[model samples]
Target: MGDVVRAPWDAYFATGFDTCSEVLRGRNWLAPDFAWQERQADTERWEAVATQEMTKTLSRLNAPEHTCQRRSLGNLFDRSTVQRLTPQVEEHVTRLLDELADKLRWGEADFVSTVSEQLPISTIGSWLGIPPEDYPHILEITHNQVHAQELLPTKEQLAVSAEATVQLRAYFTEMVRRRRERPGNDVLTGWIHTWDAREPDRERADEILYRLTMFVTIASLETTATLLSAMVELLLREPGQWKWLAEHPGHIDSAVDEVLRYDPPIHINTRIAAEDTVLAGVPIAKDSMVHVLYGAANHDPRRNENPDTFDIRRTGTHLTFGGGVHYCLGAALARMEARTLLTQLLKRFPTLRTVSPAVYAPRLVFRRVTSLGVAV
Candidate 1:
């Protein structure tokens, strides 16, 4: 659905978990095309690695292995874990806000480049067992990996950009191996044991590993960073929402949701037609590349009243995280990070405000507030 991201379109076998949930009532899919791709082999090209190699990783959110992994790991995002991470999240947020306040004391600062990016990168890196010292590198790799359009730089060039990813995968592979030799407490260690125990097939473990790495690789930072930047942009553009959120404090969850609907982090995902079908009466042939216009779909008047309006108190859930069996595995973790970051940002800097007009790439596939200067 992008204006021009053709060669490197990279349509994920992704799902709008909620979208499917809405249409199917917890039983079906939003589009038949999406359901077909859910079982396709293309996704296996990458996901196979995660499930096959990682041993413990369940590639499918609906699959039994994934269910077990989700039960174990998903608990990390539940109330107890969220409660546990709150203090640490706040402490980290305090450091960032203080850093921002310190810098703004001198002059204007690019908050998106400096602050928004830092929050998710740190949170995700910690979640993935990456060291603090390497977050900058992680950010660079994830950033380039997502934007590697193969336009100026061919797929080969894009692959070169993913050198860090290669290194990252190699590192994780070693971690998985070491854990097999001697276990530990981190999620990585847990994943290794799970992967080793499942032993679905000889190659299954590698596939699982790929899926697990890919799970956190592109989605983690891209979703969080883009959403955070969009939050700053919307809050700055709409003084009322910003003021309301600042005052209510508890409305941070609503603010996060509104931010997602107003300017979702991801805008487009494609689905291959399962067979001949119709989308809202439009004939769709089998194997057609059907673009899911999430941004437009989220704002469809049929779905939301005054779809364009940004109301933090808006009660309707949106399609930012997606729907169905393919729903984002990281949804809970992401929500917690957003709630924590926004809370800390608002609390520390009551005067928090963007100082520059945000810059966004016209790229339609992903909508990220690339840069937003701010004043504390």
Candidate 2:
């Protein structure tokens, strides 16, 4: 067993499969309380404005609110919704891949920008009825905001992030107004229907819709973008496996799940101890910060027979989307997006291979490759 890695703020890292699972699934630890109003309150900076506001999102909400939001919006992400989105996803994947065909033949092309980054933003943004023209600006704003959210960000960094957050809030506020006036078949419209059902004046509905929209639009892009690069990188590491997948297209489903398990986009999920409890015999004081290392637990030998090996046929589930109440809300869409793009990519260019070493973005909470060059 490894020793506990503690941060300056007294946060504890739980890397063991059993320990992490227990902490994540049990009621001992809870999501962020969102009670803090300022960023730099104590000696060590425990939060940033970006993170502080993010705490108010569905992922970080406590009990009743979390349950209400999840239930009301759960059907929108069900398998059927994903199936319905398949054709649109395919069109985008095809268009993006076609754009890269000429560039890849030169034996090198930055797939991260050309494919990985574009696919998610385009697909998710289009699905939500975000205007085609606004996507680039939105991605840029979110990128800046996400990077500025360092544990100990500089004064300048915080200032920039605060501005970006303001821009995002305004963009979503206007978008929500438009969607409410002219409803359609997209997710925003569906959410509008749910809220419009009970709320008469639309005050509560507008607040809820705006928050959910801002959070989902930004968070959704991060995962799918990273997962696209990570999955391709992992498969090409074992060319034989990539070839195997190309031959047996039916394995795409398992392939996507395995990628999520092997190299999850989000590495750590935090939970505050609700009450004093013992996790794997270690005492965790009430209100202590617990970091559940999903990436580590995913590869724990005890949990999987050969955790290091990236086998598409690996059975059971991983903590990639997490577990219990906080499981990733967009899990279905992420899987579908990855599976769709990879399946089509391999079929179109069976000889596609990574040409350069992957370069990861500098971030603590996310595992995103900033650049990955590939050749066909």
Best by TM-score: 2
lDDT of 2 by residue, 266-288 (tens): 88888888878777667777777
lDDT measured at residue 148 in model 2 versus the true structure, 0 to 100:
48
Task: Please give the lDDT score for candidate 2.
Answer: 0.81
Encode model 1's per-residue lDDT on 1-376: one tens digit a residue. 3221223443322233333234322332223222444555665333322222222333223344455555544444567766776676667777787788888898888887677788877776665566798777767666655543221334454455456456557665665555556666766666666666767663566556545754565566777878877877787687666666778997888888888887888776544554565444345456555455566666766667888898888887677676655566667767777788787777676776777788886556555567788876
> Which TM-score value belongs to model 1?
0.78
Lowest-scoring 10 consecutive residues by lDDT in candidate 2?
35-44
Q: 211 in model 2: Cα distance from truth in Å? A: 0.7
For all predicted structures, in order, the TM-scores are 0.78, 0.92
lDDT of each: 0.61, 0.81
